[model samples]
Target: MKRAVIGTLLATLAMVAHASTPRDLESSAVVDGTLVLAKNGTVQTVQIKDEARYGKPIADMVRKAALQWLFYPVLREGQPVLAKIDMHVRVVLQKAPDGNYTARIKGATFGDMDAKSTDALSNAESNKRIAPRYPIDAARAGVQGTVYLALRIDRSGHVTDAVAEQVNLANIGPDSALRQFRDEMAKTTLAAARRWTYQVPTTGRLASQDHWTARVPVTYTLNDRGEANPDSVWRTYVPGPYTKAPWSDKSDMDSVDAVVNDDVRTEGAGPALLVSFHQG
Candidate 1:
């Protein structure tokens, strides 16, 4: 049975790796978080470093998806050691007509943040945002996740420079399958983000700052997979001007489930748990 299980997993990994990598897609979700790795390579604890900029669901999704991920552990002298790693994941999510969404991991890279950089992004806002198009080929193959991008914004609120850093594909597959569609998704992400504009960063005094580095995350979700619809895997909730949030943010007593899963529920009107990363 162990052999069977390993073989099955390897087979799945190969299949996903062979799918087309995103080379032309234009939207992505850039996630910032930290995870504590156990000596055995399993995730011990995880946290999203920035939760203030986004709503609660975003962070919850990031952490929950993170808990299910397998990490490439830090080794010392050929032995694994307990390590804390800061990660910036670029995620891509596809949207559905109804707004309910599902996503897969796009890519993950190990890195940490500097205090100055985080402070600069704290006050920026989206002025003109563009979403990524669901890659037709990826959809046919049932690919989904949040695509992450790193951008430099000027005082004028224009995206001065943008780079397709990586996608947070922790959920895509345990192997190279995650790379298959990365380029396609990245192309879609850059094409859209280049046209986006943001509110210039400001001092607490409300003065405009010269420049800021921003992480742009685009998501693609699919609530259901339609074997018939190649893009049916692109399930995500994009709130329309006319709709309200599917989950409540205003209840006095919010109900939260697993700290790291999507099945979480909140009651009152407030942001979800978007906290900073620490030793936890």
Candidate 2:
């Protein structure tokens, strides 16, 4: 059974590795087009003259194609306003050297934000403004916690101010100790937050009320483990390779375990007695 299990594991790993590797397509078709949305929000047209063809009518192919275009309104005084946008789609067909087609599908662009021009603002300026008010001692012992702050970016291309929305360090023990750390960090971090800058749209004039909210995730790691060192406490307490087979019991083991040992403990079992029983 052990040999069979090992063989199965090796086979699964081989399959996963093979699946992860990139494969070349057998045939390819390149489709390119520009989609234009009118300012009135009533007229929409997609020009596919430059799009690739695969022996199908242009109108018929476009109608059946999975090409989509979206436009967000430029608001004015809490009212919807018109905005114009041009979108492009590309389809590539991959074919084998033996002259045989393998797959045919329409390709898509990266994303809205990716295509937009981002040279107006610098990330360093933004980071400097939003930098934490306090230096988190990530190397300190028993310092695992999350500090969440709400930041507002104004139209003037500046990180206005940051507020300590929430701080979670419950498992670190003792409220007073955690509060002291949180207060110090908040003070130092908030001071640096004033330096962060943002780039506003050059075309439109924004009112003082116009602002965007951003949430930052800060993680503190005291140690590292895993293949580097087996005796590391970080790796022991953290997640590791699964020793038990995923499909061994052929059942929802997690749900079954939750239902079985919710809060029911036998008086004599004690906390040390970890019962290993299977549930169908």
Candidate 3:
């Protein structure tokens, strides 16, 4: 369920935290756009919406990679239908020993821009969110990462249960030490999530359901200064092992990771992508 943004460690490592610093200047990046699909699931057109922000080099790599992608055909009442989808692609540039770099598409997620049109899980119009406090141990050690949380909400828009689905660390270290740090970050995130609430869908297919499932990621950065913009660029990170929520049917990993910005992704609300999105 985890996407390894960086293929291989580009630089030598040490047991210390700063030893994990990236030698190459090219950091991980994210690009998003709309993809038009034919009835048979072939990509008819690809648009690079964030080229100016991500730069042409990164945008071109994502565009070429996306053209070769094939998705599961969308169906309406067992009949094939043409569809348009919003896609977010994560790119990582790895420098080889020969001093050359290669762009790899680690993962991509496909869904509809408007969630209300589909019966699948979608976010309500209103919600109250509380940012999690940076753990003292992690902050002191200069640890930074993003924690994706899976939440179960009742019809009343109250969080009934919350779990940390995955934690990706911007810093790297020994496997044992990284796991312990991730746990500390997850603990704090879950505590804050319990106090949050959201508006339930009143018009969609899931509105009448007894409960809804939603996923949102909380990021911790040392230089955020309380005005964090996650979509500007993605920092390299080592993805931790994914923990599935007890109420989840499968590990819906791709949908949540595609959210480069601060937004809640409701389950089952967008067009279903049947094929694997890994391009690396």
**Candidate 2 structure, TM-score to reference:** 0.34
TM-score of each: 0.39, 0.34, 0.76
How are the candidates ranked when ordered by TM-score, highest leading? 3, 1, 2
Q: If both were scored by lDDT, which would come out higher, candidate 2 or candidate 3? A: 3
Better of 1 and 2 by TM-score: 1
* Residues 1-280, model 1: lDDT tens digits: 2556545544675475445433332234556678887776677898887565444777787788767666555555657688776665545555455855555445444432333422234323442335567766556555665454556667676767776544544233543444555666677877887777655434332244455555545655543552323222123321111111223222111111011111111111111122211211
**Candidate 3 TM-score, C-alpha based:** 0.76
Using TM-score as the measure, the top candidate is 3
**lDDT of model number 1:** 0.48
Error of 1 at 19 (Å): 14
Better of 1 and 3 by lDDT: 3
Q: RMSD of each candidate?
A: 18.1, 21.4, 6.9
- Tell me the tens digit of each residue's lDDT in model 3 across 193-246: 887777766664567788888888888887544333343465777777778889
- lDDT per residue (tens digit) for residues 1-280 in model 2: 2556434433443343223212321122223444443443332655554433434453345434422333343344656544333322222334466956444333232112223443122244336435442243322323333344445667675667566444433123233444555654455555765575555434323232355443343433333331111111111111111122221232221211111100111111111101221110
